[model samples]
Target: MISKAEAKHIWVLAEQKKGKVANVALEAIGLARKLASASSQEVWAVLLGQDVGGLAEGLIQSGADVVLVVEHPKLDTFRDDPYVDVLAHLAENHKPAVFLIGANSAGRSLAPRLATKLRAGLAADCVELSWDAGNLVAVRPMYGGNVLATVTCPEARPQMATLRPKASPRPVLDASRKGRVEKVDLGGLQIRDRVKLLESVETGGGEVKLEEADIIVSGGRGMGGPERFAVVKALADAFKGAMGASRAAVDAGWVPYAHQVGQTGKTVSPKVYIACGISGAIQHLAGMRSSEIIVAINKNPDAPIFKVATFGIAGDLFEVVPLLTEAVKKEMS
Candidate 1:
């Protein structure tokens, strides 16, 4: 526990999309609450976006003791310059013991920059976070998911970490819990960058992000061709899960980058992950190795995916997936 003389708080950078709170924000707050309790500190959430007042209530309900809202018209959409500048300023001002962000696209882009600006150590894609006698310890995968590394930022103030989405449990709603809302003014420090968002295109039915999905059905090179994705999609549909792909498939242009799951792609921690026709490269396992249950289906019995799979089927995925999908559909009906 931190000494009484040293004040400590858990600060989470709450993310918003289309003026609404992102699910990753809630998950971060939930994990922050747990870390706060262990360190005998308070959990505070910081929101940066235009007209973000509506998001404060949800943050409180998600276990934040105080919601620090930084509302600026420039923050309405995600721009790297303004968001990073504001977050760095807030971290310096608040001087929280620990600062956390989601390991999603936005967070991944901003976290390392914020850490550089603050001159603080940061552990990225952390699956677990805890306080070891007042020192913030972050647990992250290393060596292509072959080993787990526990890191500590004892020398840095506002010890920073980014948690992978779905790596932690979602926070329970506590409607009765009340929290303070402090609004920060972002005045002259806004920096303009060259990148500008002209238009945003939504894809894949805008389904739940693979990182946040409870169930994911992933395809690989062995899937044969992009057309064969239908078999994988059918299984995902039957399970109401999101579809994903190995980096090999994405690089081969067999699937969109959004669907890729590997070291170079999205980190996911789903309840159940079904890998179809995937050999499970080390880079790919780095992303989804934390899944609660991994099911692998591949024609090759010697595929590397079977090593990490909780259940393995040594058969053609094309044959197996359709049968499994039909069985699931029948059960659901």
Candidate 2:
């Protein structure tokens, strides 16, 4: 256990893949900047990957005071052991006061491992974060989106938490910012090569990554069938947004599983989420209730989705979607 006096800088695990930095890192950095300011501390980013040095500039501009680079050819593709080994070593030495991670697939796996190794308290999938009484408070949905729970790691020296992607506003880019980038050597580190990644196929084809989209047009069981998703696609295309589907839609084979958004699928915090013909089940709201704006279009006026929506259109989506799509295109023209 580390003492409060011994704990220093706020460290954000700058998760990246194949050299491109994950967008969530920027949001985490933005939050770290706020948390660090309260304590008059520094925000340090720990980037782990091969050939990731080029990304240091972007991280620095995004609000990190220092970027710690861990480069290794073995890290080109994410391997559990090597990554855990390197980060565990850093935490052992630096003892950061707060550690933030993106709550993505890789981060979900890494945070728990590091938290266990460091014996730190961890709050996962936090939608909000702030300092209260000198403790970092993490707020996340609980009871299947029925309520929010605020968690705190008061006794832990290095408080650990994972922020859902886009939980915080994106940090403004300041190219004028200057920061230090230090390359750390991972020598004498014994890594257990138990898992091997033989083949990695990219999903989404040419479609936009659902989680990264600023706007999403999604459909549900009310959309009728797979062929009817064309209207949903048109609305999505009209907005230059991504296409999404509720679990019922995916389970019904109306769309691929990749487009699913719900408790069992991807969590999206887009600028705008248009729910077309979705009944707004609690499971689905848990994934996207954090969106900046929600427009619910459902035939049922009492659909639960309208509860969290910024705008509600209680009308037949069959008639609404095409007219809405035409209006958007006409305005753009």
Candidate 3:
């Protein structure tokens, strides 16, 4: 077991895709900056990919005091075992005080594995974090998001946690902020790649990411049918935004699960979230309550969605949506 004195830095997983850094990784760095400042520890980002050493300087600027790059041909895609093994080796060698992984596709699968390998305490999907006399404390949603639980790892040397994307504030790009670029080696450890990604297919008509969208227009059961969802699509198109759906809309076969947003689905914190005909169930609100601005359009004046919405439109979506879409198009044009 490593002592607190042996653990010296805060490590942030720099998850990347298609040779570019994912937004969640930058968000992790932003969070690590704050946590490192509180604990008087240096912030380091673990960058692992082929030809990703070019991203180290950018990570340093993003908030990392040092960027640890593990470049190899076998580490191109999001293969689970190689990634976990490499990180485990790193943790065992250079013990960190805090280890943070973004709660995204790659991270969700990787966090627990790494934690178990290192025998470290892990907090999953934490939305908020604070320091209690230099110890890290994590706060996350509980009981279908009806409650928030604050957790601390008192027995672990290197505390581990996975943070949902957009749970922390994005840091401003500062080119002047620079640090060290470190290339880490595997020490002759043979990495056996079992999973081979043969091909990849892209779905969704509009090429927009729901999680990173600045504007999102979502439809619920009020859309009636997939055909009626055209108005919602039109609105999203007019704004050049992404399309989202409540669980009801997705379960009804109106849209795919990729568009679903809720407690059971994806948690999104877009800049502007427009809910069309959504009843605003507790589960749904739990996913998007963090949006910068929320607009609710529902026929029922007493709909719960209106309570959390920044703007309320008490009208039938069939009549209101088309007109609204046209107005948005006109305003933008």
Candidate 4:
């Protein structure tokens, strides 16, 4: 068993697919950089995939001091069992002081299992992380994001946490930042495939993914019906942004569940979030309250959404959205 005293490096799991690294992975690396600096340790990024060594340079530019690349044919796709098997093996052998994972769909599934394997503690969906003395302190939202809980694992050799995407500023890529690349050999390790990935299908909705979007325009119950959602789309198109919908609009069948943004749906932290006709339910705010800029348009001046909005319009969205779209178009033109 690896002891706490032997742990030296702070590790971040740098997730990638088909040579394209996930934004959240870079964000985790950015967070890990800060913690590593505070604790006077090296920030090591562990990347797993087939033929992904070329992607290591990008992680280096994103603030990783070392990129540990583990390549295998079984890792070509993201299957829970194989991924967990490989990651757990690495954790056991290398013995990092801290392990940070992105709190996306894949990380959420992988973290708990990896923690169980290492017999360590895990903080899920953490929004903030810091080094408190020698222990890693993670802050996560609880009870529909109304409460922020602070967690720490003082005794665990490798403290682990799944950090939310867009919670931290993305590190600026610097080619001048020098880092080392190391290849991990997976010899004699029997990677188990308990679950077979039958097929992976893409669910297409819009050009920009909500999670990665810089700007988002969402509509809600005040849209009145499904056909009226065109107004919301027009505004999103004008801003070259992604389209989002409140649970009320989705439940009302105005849009697909994929576009729903709330505690029950996809969490988004866009640079600009424009809410039209959405009365800010705590569940809804829990998802997008972290957005840098929020614009709310509701006829009701007393709407809860206005409380969190950076800019609010108390008027009819049907009239207001089109005008805003035209104004944006004119500005862009």
Please give the CA lDDT of all the candidate structures: 0.86, 0.89, 0.88, 0.92
Q: How does candidate 2 fare on TM-score?
A: 0.94
Worst 10 residues of 3 by lDDT: 200-209
The residue-by-residue lDDT of candidate 4 on 11-97, one tens digit each, is 999999668888999999988898888889999999999999999999999999999999999998777899999999998988998
Location of the lowest summed lDDT over 10 successive residues in candidate 4: 200-209
- Candidate 3: tens digits of C-alpha lDDT, residues 86-180: 88888888899889998888898999988888888888988897777767899987776778899998867688889887788777778999799
Candidate 4 structure, TM-score to reference: 0.96
Kindly give the stretch of ten consecutive residues in candidate 1 with the minimal lDDT sum: 1-10
Clash list (residue pairs), candidate 3 = none
To one decimal, what is the Cα RMSD in angstroms of model 3 from the true structure? Answer: 1.8
Candidate ordering by lDDT (highest first): 4, 2, 3, 1
Off by over 4 Å in 2: none
lDDT of 2 at 270: 94
Predicted candidate 2 versus true structure: per-residue lDDT over 32-76, tens digit per residue = 999888878899999988888999999999999999999887677
**Candidate 2: lDDT of 325?**
98
- Once fitted onto the true fold, the runs of candidate 4 whose alpha carbons sit more than 4 angstroms away are none
| Rank ordering of all candidates by TM-score, starting from the highest | 4, 2, 3, 1
- Candidate 2, which ten residues in sequence have the lowest lDDT sum? 185-194
Highest TM-score against the true fold, candidate:
4
